[model samples]
Structures are given as C-alpha cells and as structure tokens.
Target: MQGINRCPPVKIFVGLLFAFALNVMVFTQIYGQEAVDSNIISYTDKLAYGVDLSTDIDEFIVSGPDTENFHLVTNNDVKLTLRLNYKFLNLSFGFSPGFLSGNDDDELKGDSSFTEYQVNMFPGRFVQNVFFRRMKGFYVENTEDFVPLWQEGTDPYLQFPDLKSIEWGGYTGFVLNEKFSLRSLLNRQEWQLTSSGSFIPALRYNFTKLANTFESGSYGKENQVDLRADLGYYYNYVVSPKVNIAPYARAGIGPKTSKYTLDGVVDKNTYFVSDYGGGLQLGYNTDQLYMGIRGSFNGYTYKDESDNTISNNLWHGLFYIGYRFETPEKLKNLF
Candidate 1:
C-alpha cells in the first residue's frame, strides 16, 4: 500500500485534465474555421462515445555475457474502456473487472495492479500525448532457467511482490502531409475519402523509477530520464468510402541517464538507447457509427553500468465500437 501510495494522487490527474481542456479551447479558437478540401476530408459535428476492450502486456529481459536471460512479466488482463469525444476534446476511463482479470495464481506469479492516466491532443498538424503509469508486482517468466528441474505446471516462479514502477512521460509530433487526415483514422472526428500517407517526426521523453520494498544493499532503486526523436510513416488505404486500413512504423534512438542505489551506494551512468514499433488498424466508419481493431508492439533496450543489457517490451491489442449522435444544445453552447 505504501508503494502504490507514492504515486501521484487523483488531484494531479484532474490537473492534467484541466490542462488538456485549455489546449483544446486555445487550438480550436485558432483553427476552427481553417478551410480544407471538403472533397477529401469531412467532419462530423456530432458527439461520439465508445467502448474499447484491450490487452496490454509488458516484458522485461536482463542478460549479461556470463549470464542467461531473465524474463519478468506482469499478468496480462483485459481492460474495459469508456470513451467520449466532442469537437476536439476526447476523454476515456478504463478499469479491469474482477471476472476479466484472469486467474490469480498469486503463489506462483504474485499479485499485480496497474494504473494509468493519458491524454491525447491534436491541434492542426501537431499531435501530443501526455500520460502517467504506475505498476506493482512482477514474476519471473523464465523460471526453469534459474530453478533446476522446475515443473512447469506444478512449480512456482520467483515473484517480486514488493517491486514497483512509475513513469511520467509524453510525446509531441507533427504530421507532414496536408492531404492526410490523421484525425480521421485516430479520433474518428474526420472522415477521409481518399487514400493518403504522411511522414511524422516526434520527440519523446520519460522519467521512470523502479524500486523494491527490500532493505538497503539489495537492488534498492533505479531512476532513469530519457529523450528520443522518432520518425514514422503512416498510410491509410481507403478500401471503401466507409472503410480503411492503416499501417504505421517508427524507430528512435536517444540518450538515457540512469541513477542507481544499491547497498546504500549510489552510481550514475548515461547510455544511448534504441526504440522501435509498428502497428496496424482496420476500421469501418459512418456518420452515426464506427468500429475498429488495432494491434501494436513497442520496445527499448539499453546497457547498464555492469555491461548487463536490459530491455523492455510492450504489446497490446484493442477492439472498439462507437456511436455518434447530435450534440445537445447545452453541449454546443459550451463550445
């Protein structure tokens, strides 16, 4: 409870929402009337709401010249999300229901919980995302590699019940092509009638901390600050006026500064890390209804002070269905 309590509270999340609202107001005031090719792009004044089902899993791997790989993982459970969009504003809330939280064999894999708050804003050709994530508990995925003659179905894996991780980060980027409609594909606020592609370049940053509840002298804690620049390409193939398929890929290299505390001793080091990912989305859109499915994977790798290489990877898939309706008079008045 103490470890989880160290995370930012609800008030901080509310502050993020306030900041996002300000961005939407300022950006819409400046670009609301900007004209575009209507034949190629179209907008809907209706309000939209949706339900999304998703699964996200993280894997951490550590290896050294004289050591075999050690894999750590958290339970990959289903998350249910409710999303709402009005004009340029979007909001979402997500949670895992007990029934969907998969079997909890805590003795073998330990218990885990994940909490995150994220916001995405689009102002013209610019894209921005800000988020915070906190995760607790993990278990070794490759138990047989360390525990000799371990039975797969009967033996328990090594669990890190006291481990905790927290991250604060975001990304800002620009879309290159004026003919492309990123909003059409991502937010469902605009619909594209023609197939097009764009080159996007983004800057990403993160402040991360990893720690355990064990006493000093052990793997006490590690803090990392990193910044990277990525270039990605996205293309939407308009299979029909109401359907599209999109594929995108990106890669980045960055500088990472890490501080470590072990046995009450502290050490600091810097390294260059590399990141890469790609994803695909298929969607069907109409004036009053929309649905889609998407899958993506991303990862980063770096070498530590002891020459041990550590890598983190995340893979997720999502299915969403949404409805659009006329904006109520009161909602329109607010805008």
Candidate 2:
C-alpha cells in the first residue's frame, strides 16, 4: 500500500517534466523564426544600401504684382536627381541640367534675358526644392527688366534654381504593429516607403543652398533653410510573392526661416508653406535584391509676406534598384 502511494507522486513528476520540455521546444522554434525574419526583408528592412534616380516635372504660373490680371506660364520644368542611401542615412547630389528645352524657346517669347534667366535659374530652383517641394522667387536685380519679358503693364520673373547641391541626412524607424509603423527623419530626403504595407509619420529639418561657382565658375550663390513635418501612410497589395503594389498619401506644413541675397539684391521674402501628395509604387522583392518604380503628384502652396498665395504643382517620379551586401559568402562558413 505504501509503494502504490509513492508511485502516484513519481507519475505526477514525470508528467510535469514532459510538459516543461515540450514548452521549451516550442519556445525555441518561435525564437528561431523571429531571428530569421528580422535579418531578411520582405519589401523593407532595418539596413540597406542602394541608389535611386528621380526627377520633378513642374508647371508654374505667375500672376499679378499689382493686379490680378498679370499672368505668365512656365511649363515642363524638369530637375534630375541621383540619390544614395545606407539604412537610415542618405546623401543626394543634384545639378541643373534642363531637359526638354524644345518649346521653352517660344514659351519665353524669344526674349534673350528671359531665356537667360530661365536657363540659368534651373539649377538653383531645383536645388532649393526640399523633399520635392519647391520655393517661389524672382531673381531679378532691377524691377525694370520686367518689360518685354513680362506683360508690358504687368510684372513677372521667376525661374528654377540653377546650380549644384548636396543633401545629407538620416532617419530612424519604430514598429507599432504589422499594419503600421513610425519613422522620423533629420535630413533633406523624403518619402520613406515599404512594399508590404505601413503608415509612417515623420518630422524633418532641411537646409538647402545654391553654389556660387560650379563646373569652372558656373552657377550663383543663394541659400534657404526650413523646418517641416509630414504625416504619411501607405498600403500594399500583393500580386505574388515576388511582386507587389503600394499606394501612399502624405501632408505637411512648416516655415521658411532664412533669406539670401541674389545679384546685389537682398531678398525680403517671408514664407509659410503647405504640401500634400499621393503616389503609387510597383516593386519586386527577393532575398538579396529589391527594385521598384514610383510616381506621385506633389503640390506646394506658399503664402508670402504680402499675403499673396502662390502654388506650384508637379508630377514627381522615381526609379530605384537595391541589393543588400551584409550576408557575404564568407559568413556562411562561420558555422
């Protein structure tokens, strides 16, 4: 009778021991899967290095220095960009090389000064653009130059930035869940995206400038600095394991806090800026590489010191191709 009683305790102990062992095995498997998932990206990752090519196509209009009747049309102004990124950090370098100048000749009405101003202003104008948003300004030293170039009785003069520029910055990311995350940036870049799906809210500060001389004393000196924030969101649709589509939206506002001198003239300009946009991205994802094309419509409205509102609208597009290099062939030999 004593032996039978003792057997019950021993049986209970074995049962508990088996259950604990089973739980440990299950936990180990889950941990292994999580570790693997963190290292490999679906359409995005914690670290990556890659390059991107993009451009902005702008259609701008100028109306009234005195009356609402003054109007001038500037069309198809293009700025080409090249970007390099490493994880949360990025650096972009851009130069003004105006493409599709075909109808630009007639658009300025054969006035050499207008043509000169339009051609020379592209680099600086494009460089001043922060995160695909452009500033509005006229670089004329004398107001008298508006005649013949503008409507005879009205006022007009503004051109794209013509110059060389360098942009450098960094970003940080946090995950909230499978469907949402947050990213914050302190840099000159814009639009942080993922292929699976995510909502990213961001904050930023940007400093943009124009070069006094580039390519053997070409381009001029102008600079502007600004602070801004954006609320961004996107969702992904899967077509296959390797391909997907993402559509996104963003809106933001801030202020232009600094001014610069242009051609012996101090620019007495003050600005309050607002921007919003939407776009789509198509991507192909794999273990070692990811690439995609994205297109978006971007608009910016600026209120100057005179309380005059100016709007610039653009179709911005980007092409990206990236390959991760962290897991080299030699790493597999460590085991």
Candidate 3:
C-alpha cells in the first residue's frame, strides 16, 4: 500500500513538469506569431493628432555699442502636429502661427513681428520636410513710432517690409540609439523680398526621446517633465550675406529653435538689423493624441560705426488645439 501511494506522487510530479513545458512552448509560438503580424501591418494606418503651445524668454543679448542692445520679447505660438506611426515607423505634419512683440526702455527701440510656419516630416525611415513661412513686422524707434506704421498716412518706410518664404527639404536619418538620431537635410528656400532662392544644408542630432518615456509608462505622475538637447550646424543663405553657422540647443517639453541676430553697421549708420530668438514648447501626449502650447521670442539689435547698439525684446502668445486617430492594435488581454 505504501509503495502504491509513493507511485501516485511521482506520477503527479512528472505530469506537472510536462504541462509547464507545453505552456512555455505555446507562449513562445504566440509571441513569434505576433511579431510576424506586426511586421505585416502598415505603420501609416496608425495616425494620431496633436497640438502644442509654448512660451520662451531670452537670457541675454550680445551686440556692439550701437549694435548691441537688450530688450525683452515674448511670443505666442500655436501648433497642430499629426503623427502617422506604427511599430517602428513614424511620420509627422505640423502647422504653427506666431505673434511677437518687443518691450523697450530708454536707449532701446521696440518692434513687432508675426509669422506662420508649416512643416511636413517623416522622422525615421527617410526624413523629409516641407515648410512655408510668412512674417511681417515693424521696427520702431519707440512705442509711439510703432503706432504710425499701422496708420495709412504714417511712414510705411519706417516699418519693416512683409516677408514670405517657402522651403522644401529631404534628409536621411540614422538612429544611433534610443536617445540619439543623426540627420542631414538639404533644403531650398524662396524669399519674397529678395525674390532670391537659398540652399541650406543642416546637420542635427536629437538628444532626448522625451516622448518615448511617456509611452513607456514612466511619466504617469502629474506634471512629469522631459528635457532634450540638440546641437546642429546650419549653413544657410537667407538670413545673412554670408553663410551663418551657429550651434544651438533646445531643452524643454519638446523641440525648439535657437535665436540669433545679424547686425551690420557702416560709418555711424546702421543697416540690416534683425533679431531672432529661440522658441519654447510645452505639451502633453498619450498613445492616441497630444496637446500643448508654444511661445516665440523676438528681439532686435542695431549698431553704428561708433559702436552704439540698440536692442529690444517683446512677447506674444497663442493657443493651439488638435486631435489624432490611429489604427488600433489587437487586444491581447481581456478581463
């Protein structure tokens, strides 16, 4: 009787081990099938929409005596970005409208600028981007001077002319890691004022995949933040007489551009004075969609041969709203 009892226990142990091995084999097969199915599905079918708003401020200005001046500027920008993504493939489209204004004290002048920019892009597979931009503004000696430019009888020549531009470009990107992507873009831009075309070559690297953290269930807490840094070389003909090359970094909720000013002075005379500042963007995103705000900073510096510089900065902000829809994946678990 004791031997019989021991035999049943041994048999039961063997049966349990066999069942566990079979489950493991079944799980491996299911995972393999899912991977194959994922490859067969087109990523474009999964598209989502997003909106962003941003605000930014410049830390300081570097200029000459007549050319180097400082003023505070503010910008309000609204953007709608769409994403087409599946598995490892991703594409995006974006549109932004911005308003900028300058605040000035004595010895510094004020200005107002407005711009609208739109872009279409494919991020990973083969990077491509097309953009259109329009800007209009007035450079004023003072607040009183700016009002006259808007008046019909006032001095139109005193104000900066309206500028419009369109650009198209394609680039290839290689992903070095989850946090880095190297890209090079060749672009052609048309400027309305000069009626001239410009070719630009740019190489940039993305340092942080902030959006990925959100997707990975890492930022589930309230007020989660992500920071990304970028370093880039832009050789372009539109902004300056010579190729202006600068390195810039963007750290915040999302991607940003850096601001620079180009100033040229002749014999106590100032010519071609322009201000450019980086942008700030903040947004929240989920698997299905995203929403956010953006702000632009604009400022100007004017210099004379004697080394007198006048600069002013201003602020403007805008609100953005958008949505996205993506193809749903198969649900694996039902409870």
TM-scores for all candidates: the values are 0.91, 0.51, 0.34
Q: Which candidate wins on TM-score?
A: 1
C-alpha RMSD of candidate 2: 21.0
Looking at candidate 1, the ten consecutive residues that score lowest on lDDT are 1-10
Instruction: Give candidate 1's whole-model lDDT.
Output: 0.82
List clash counts for every candidate, in order: 1, 13, 40
lDDT (0 to 1) per candidate:
0.82, 0.44, 0.30
Please tell me which predicted candidate would have the highest lDDT against the true structure. Answer: 1
Q: Roughly what TM-score does model 1 have, to 2 decimal places?
A: 0.91
Ranking by TM-score: 1, 2, 3
TM-score-wise, the better of 1 and 2 is 1
Model 1 agreement with the true structure over 125-205: per-residue lDDT tens digits:
777788788777888999999999998768888888778888989898888998888777777778778889999999999
lDDT score for residue 239 of model 3: 30
Please provide, for model 2 over 1-335, each residue's C-alpha lDDT reduced to its tens digit, 9 standing for 90 to 100. Answer: 01111123234434533543454355446543222123123322323445556555554334447635222333324334444433222334343333445224422322111111000000100111123222222232233444455653244343232322322221222232343222111111222233345555555555655343333433345465655576667666666766767788888887765465544566645577787889887777665666788898987677666555666577767777766555344533431
The segments of candidate 1 whose C-alpha lies over 4 angstroms from its true place after superposition are 1-5, 24-33, 39-44, 101-103, 215-219
